[model samples]
Target: MANSRVFLAGLCLVLSAAILVYPSRAVTAAPNSAQPKLVDKDAQESIDKGLKYLANTQRPDGQWYPSGSYGTYPTVMTSLAGLALMAGGSTPESGPYAKNVRRAMHYILRVAEAEKDGLIAGA
Candidate 1:
């Protein structure tokens, strides 16, 4: 119970940070609407917060909840994080999360090289 509370608190903090950081990326218009309408800023803020939290809470090795103590955690984390970064449009060259994406990609690649079957190729 205590652990759950801690986790929830962390999640909330991350979400708040995202809303404060990226206000513009909150929403997209629904298709086929007869009238043009803007999205809710507060709701968009909530979504951005969630994304930020997920990104922030990722383990250093790249995985969210990695298992296997013998370096497997790092491998798994890297693969998972790399995929997540990619989904967020992070790349080696540019984008808000370029650095993180590059790092995760590198980590996953290194793990793959070290042990071919150790990590999943795709997150």
Candidate 2:
């Protein structure tokens, strides 16, 4: 019985490691949220352009805060930008600004995950 427990523990460890090293489906999977459903072409274009502007304004190190900025304004700006894109029904897989949105989503996810201890930020 003790040996069985050890073997199971080892197997579990290996499986957990594999899961961590493997790419997360969250990064590639379609969002399940009905709130982010796709929109018309023109609307999508607008969302894409807006996201483009936000991404273009980001710092080279992938941040919305300017150097020597005060308060959480940077965080707030980034958060708002992400929310706007999400509200416009954008995703990394299928959206008007899929690439830029994905990049922005990734940045916000990192911050949210680090601060909130969860991946429930952009989605």
Among all candidates shown, the one with the greatest lDDT: 2
Q: lDDT of each structure? A: 0.53, 0.54
Q: Give each model a TM-score.
A: 0.45, 0.40
Candidate 1 Cα misplacement greater than 4 A, ranges: 1-31, 34-43, 58-74, 116-123
- Scored by TM-score, the top model is 1
Residue 20 of candidate 2: its Cα lDDT? 37
Model 1 backbone overlap count: 3
Displacement of residue 27 (Cα, Å) in model 2 is 29
List the lowest-lDDT window of 10 residues for candidate 1.
114-123
- Per-candidate clashes come to 3, 0
Candidate 1 local Cα displacement, residue 33, angstroms: 3.2
The deviation in Å at residue 76 for candidate 1 is: 3.7
Per-residue lDDT of model 2, residues 33-67, tens digit only = 75565587898788678767776776643457645
Return the clash pairs for model 2, or none.
none
Model 1 C-alpha lDDT per residue in residues 52-104, reported as the tens digit of each score? 76567665654466555654455556555555554554555556666665555
